[model samples]
Target: MSFSVNKTIAQINERIRKGKAVVLNAEEMTEAVKRMGKEKAAREVDVVTTGTFSPMCSSGMLFNTGQPGPQTIKTAKVWLNNVPAYAGIAAVDAYLGATEPSEDDPLNKVYPGQFKYGGGHVIEDLLAGRSINLKAQAYGTDCYPSKLQERVVSLADLPYAQLLNPRNCYQNYNAAINTTKRIIYTYMGPLKPNMQNVNYATAGKLSPLLNDPLFRTIGLGTKIFLGGGVGWVLGAGTQHVAKPQRTERGLPLSAAGTLMLKGDMKGMNSRYIRGLSFLGYGCTIAVGVAIPIPILNEEIAWFTGVDDSDILMPVKDYGRDYPNCDFKTIQHLNFADLKSGEVEIMGNKVPSVPLTSYAMSLECANTLKSWIEKGDFLLTEAQEAIPAG
Candidate 1:
């Protein structure tokens, strides 16, 4: 007799609660699938977790501060530690963008100004329990008399603080190179001229979206590990292209899918959420995100079995092509080739490095796996699947 495996997320959760669900990280699942085949592996494995740590430029936070005084002042302008925030929301609510620079910083006044601090750093400082300088300007009115507010505030002082990122955890991204004579600074870090260096951002095989390329198990309302805390997928992210150029193995060659994520700042860890600034580039935040894949059948198992060699990245010239909105690719490379430290481009050998940290990605996967094995975390069924183009 033969049995086909098809497990529901609820069943997996029950097994997890009973301390019997077989959970593995993406790396382990790959090896298991190799040894036992997809059929057998799918039946044995309950869940496979995935992770990625990369600079998500389109990420930020939302906070609501209580009425500073007795008057109900509507904030026209808001600044947190010299960094401007969008205060067009409610009375005292504001949204801080990660890429927003501090007003005090002389940006571009000097060539390639070092954006040492910005919104990302503000978020980090708040999470670290440091005091923040809050200043807001408002036009005084009859009902709301207060015009200006300034004071020191900590994370706990705020009524609500949420990490509401518009986009994070990209499915797959580009390998950036500079074809110009001079070095160029970008979010991918500085790229040497003449394609001397190649920089790509992704956890490759360990990436959450790559392990489930088709969004089978990941979607809106799916529970995830975000910034070292439990978060939920809000929806498909901005600039999300559900369908894009792909290889024979069905891996996207460009930035195909992205995620809109939200989590509570109170429950987050500072280590997983970091502030980063590239030399010539502006400010951004490095967010740690992970997703758990529940193995429902052989196909899901096969998806999780993808190796680094199977995931391909498109190499685009940041010098001109990318800046001009040209999606033209000079070549395609696999993580296996990138991890080797160097790859050949146009018959010339160039050094390759990952902008995302593989060690942190591994740690995220292991941490999520442990949460499941210890019955602290349960897999969630996506209420609605992500949109497919």
Candidate 2:
């Protein structure tokens, strides 16, 4: 059966009017789906909350760093606590990429995994009320001329430090392992060679997009709990693949739909959004995101009901370049099997590591519930449907 957006909105409004809007968290919804059945669950449940906490390499922060340093310094190079921040923009404005490593000690050939600090970590430090050393350099010029600048900056010091993530919650992701003999530093984290370990991002069955499957209930303008504060879906994120191999339920057999998210970094704390440095690998940002899914109809209910067994991810070789073309040779495993801590690949029980934090994700969902209950947030419809791949 098809879902009606207008009808769903009315149902939600009525429940809100009656002060009985039933909002269920991810764990609760999973059980509700099984016990109440899709039809009944759809009829009763007003909202299904989904959450995930994972490393997003595409995340960055735009900062206003208080005032322009002594003299009108047009910052050409910027670094915060050894990590690089983009400072080529207008004076005093800067953007720090999550994956940017320090110039002095970057993720390189000699000691690839030795970096203890990254752009993400610098952000975390600044959020924790710690002062970060800021240094910038520029060529002496007739206007806004300053060759050097240095100071300490904190979140309190900057009026604007917005979390502008070009990409965040991926629709899906692959489980990566190394088939080669050498260890590989990858975006999915270090992959152990010879199928030693499989690393996967996303909370698997608990991810937001995984529940929605099709973006009917989630799209641009969907308000989400992002890095501890409210954020909105701007549009399709970078590398968005609208279509991928799908199962009978329309859930992808691999990574699919993605979201471009933006939020105010000033209102956030280090508790939810943390900066991380991968040994020998570059820096990456870990963001917490959660959304409320309206049970528009039975189909949505069924989609929300998808459990670990319903989701499958391809185990690919991270040793090779990304978008690995040899996907046919990759083994697909269900989240249920993957969640077992180990999965038998080629008759060998290989340990699996979740790159996403389930605990943080649950916190995000519950936090959103509190927001809805407090009437601080509401569901919104996308102005336009997300385009297909």
Candidate 3:
């Protein structure tokens, strides 16, 4: 990411000066010069071509093409080098300050009448195939059956006999019971099923009855029930209550439950959760690129060895077309001007070409030059750089 302005310029100058010069036969000097011009053109083209391909050399390549202004080149270089660090810093900040609730925080609400613990249980049940039902209650409506009615109704109107039913009686017997036996169900309800005293005893036994061959074929989970169909059932005598499982859509819970579930908690229990973090890492990098920042954009272009054509094109359009036009394209166009001691981009001094089109030209030039220098007209030095597959 670091760059020395003086060092870069010096290296460029030295390369140009040290490059071998062509000597031609006197009889064909015209032809030789033409050939030399073509060769030089080709060499210059090669430099332009490879420069475009060179990672972190976008600004350098652009200069060879005579397109970008000095300011644009400078700005691009600065931009490219700074993006990764900026993104890294931002990522660290986000990772440290992510404010969502932790897995164990019971207060974190996911969905109405749904607690994080319950959501996890639901996931586990879905995996293990123990009977699971999620009853979604409309707010302010009587969703709980009559068993929970008493909990919602005022106890002041309850008769002594009705309040003192032995099965429902409690320490605050009179106050606790009501005309009806319904209970108050909140979004934060526990994962355990709510049932009347009579229902509770029978509900536990239902699991065993459901193990019958007739019921075993249908899946006994929340999704199956909500979707209005029976699904495959788990084997009878499955002692363990199901635990939560991870999926792409996230924890199968209400909104409140989702909030209560922690990313770290998933990391601890599931291998799938670990993979999510890696996926997030890649997403974070992509987000960093999408964020608007001038220097960072340039830095990306430099690292990729591509021009910030989106930014550079307007600047290049104002420049005039030159005779040897191959080099004056893309980010390289600007760099070409810089090498010629034109510190300023004035009027129409820059060159304009389609980003893709210019890239091809630079690529051809570099390929030709590489072939001449490396004695392989068909293969580029870059191609040679690659190890045999």
Structural similarity to truth (TM-score) of each candidate = 0.96, 0.91, 0.13
How would you encode candidate 2's per-residue C-alpha lDDT over 239-275 as one tens digit per residue?
A: 8888787899888877788889888877776888888
Please, what's the RMSD in Å of model 3?
Answer: 35.0
Query: What tens digits encode model 1's per-residue C-alpha lDDT throughout 1-389?
Result: 23388888999999999999999999999899899999999999999999988899899989987786866788889999999999999778999999998888765556547677789989988888899999988898887678888889999999999999998888889999999999999999999998899999999889998888888889988999988899999889998988887666567888899999999999898889898888889899989888999999888899999999998888999998999988798888888999999998889899998899999999888888899899999888898999655
Using lDDT as the measure, which candidate wins?
Answer: 1
User: In candidate 1, which residue pairs get closer than 3 Å at backbone N, Cα or C atoms, i.e. clash?
Assistant: none
Candidate with more favorable, higher lDDT: 1 or 3: 1
Of 1 and 3, the candidate ahead on TM-score is: 1
lDDT scores of the candidates, listed in order: 0.89, 0.81, 0.18
TM match of model 1 to true structure: 0.96
State how far residue 184 of model 2 sits from its true place (Å): 2.8
Q: Per-residue error at 183 for model 1, in Å?
A: 0.6
Q: Indicate which candidate wins on TM-score.
A: 1
In every candidate, how many clashes are there? 0, 7, 56
User: Which residue pairs collide in model 2, if any?
Assistant: 112-280, 113-279, 113-280, 114-280, 120-275, 121-275, 172-255
Q: Give lDDT tens digits, candidate 3, residues 49-95.
A: 11111000000000011112111111111111011101122111101
